[model samples]
Target: MSNLDQARVASRSTETTRAALIKAATSVFAEYGYDGGSVRLITQRAMANQAAVNYHFGGKDGLYREVLIAATRAFEENAFLDPEELDALSPEDALRRYLHQFLLPLVKRDRVSRFLRIFAWESVQPSEVFSAFIANSPPRIFRLAERVVRRFLPHDASAEAVTFAMLWLAQQPMFFVRDAERLAQPPFSLKFDEDALERLVDTLAGLSLRGLSGV
Candidate 1:
């Protein structure tokens, strides 16, 4: 075979190994966390040589960072309205859209639940890599929430007050997502179908506006 053709085949093989490592590592880390998840186990799961992790990702920390960034990217992409779109809408409308998108991922529970599992583990015992990932990532949703929230608050509201109000608004769905399993069972027995979701969004929006009014 020509040198160029051989090089192309080698490139494909390299990427396949890298992708496999990431997929395996995501599952392992999600279940075991960074410290608990060993490189041996990850390499074994990937069916790749132990050296491949270092060759592709520098080491386990780098691999973990890639997995984290991958897991959160989809949700981050879909969960927020563009700032321009948010600006065009009235505060009530913008908030409703934002909250709707926030809850939209709940419908894709299988995929989103995996990501949530990874996040839950990290939250309890964060890794240095996860901290760096968060530090570098843009705070897209929070900024959107802050913009929507400012419309509700007086112009003179302090930064602390604005941040607190944003957290309060954002926490509504965050709490729901975190407790989704528990909320599914029990007396709540809540199902997040289209009609139910709309109602919940409306309820939260109403509560948020009223709650913000007093802030």
Candidate 2:
């Protein structure tokens, strides 16, 4: 219609194309990984021009980097509790909620799944790209957990002792997710359903409280 309306339409079109590229690239990187995933494949999947990748994202590496960041942000928003939420909870309750949120991504199977896949690939192959991101991104959840755990520990406990306690609490779910595939099958046959997850949070919280009191 008018010049201003045409400019607005063009801006919306650019954003749509960029989002499509990122979405398609995420799947490509997840399936074939960075080295194996090509610009042509990503563009074809996005239904955007090949030149659009370079124009919008600099190149394939940059696009993959963006995908990783977007995936992580989604997980953070889904799984991380705000400081206010923790403030409203008691020490034990906070710990339980934190653990529950931390484990949510494993069961949700959304964008975070692709993120986890790419992360696993990077862990085995040692990519500079992922390494840089990890180095830059401080583990915010660790700090939150540490604060909650401090209330359970003795007043005289050392910082190192508190850190070790937090590590113990955090490691349970981390290792569980890593071994989930095997645990899902026969023999163990664990299912992380809603009821199971509630029990899991309760059990872990109880163990942590007992263990912390002993320390």
**lDDT at 66, model 1:** 82
Model 2, range 1-215, lDDT digits (tens) per residue?
A: 99999999999999999999999988787666677778999899899998899999898778877887797687578754676778788887888887787666456666766665555445346567767876887344556667778878888999899989877776666555545666789999999877887888788778877887788
lDDT of 1 by residue, 65-120 (tens): 88877766755675536777888998889888878766654555555455655655
Q: Clashing pairs in model 1? A: none
Candidate 1 residue-wise lDDT at 190 = 77
Q: Give every collision pair in model 2.
A: none
Q: In model 1, what is the error at residue 151, expressed in angstroms?
A: 1.5
lDDT of each: 0.76, 0.75
Q: What RMSD value applies to candidate 1?
A: 3.8
The deviation in Å at residue 150 for candidate 2 is 2.5
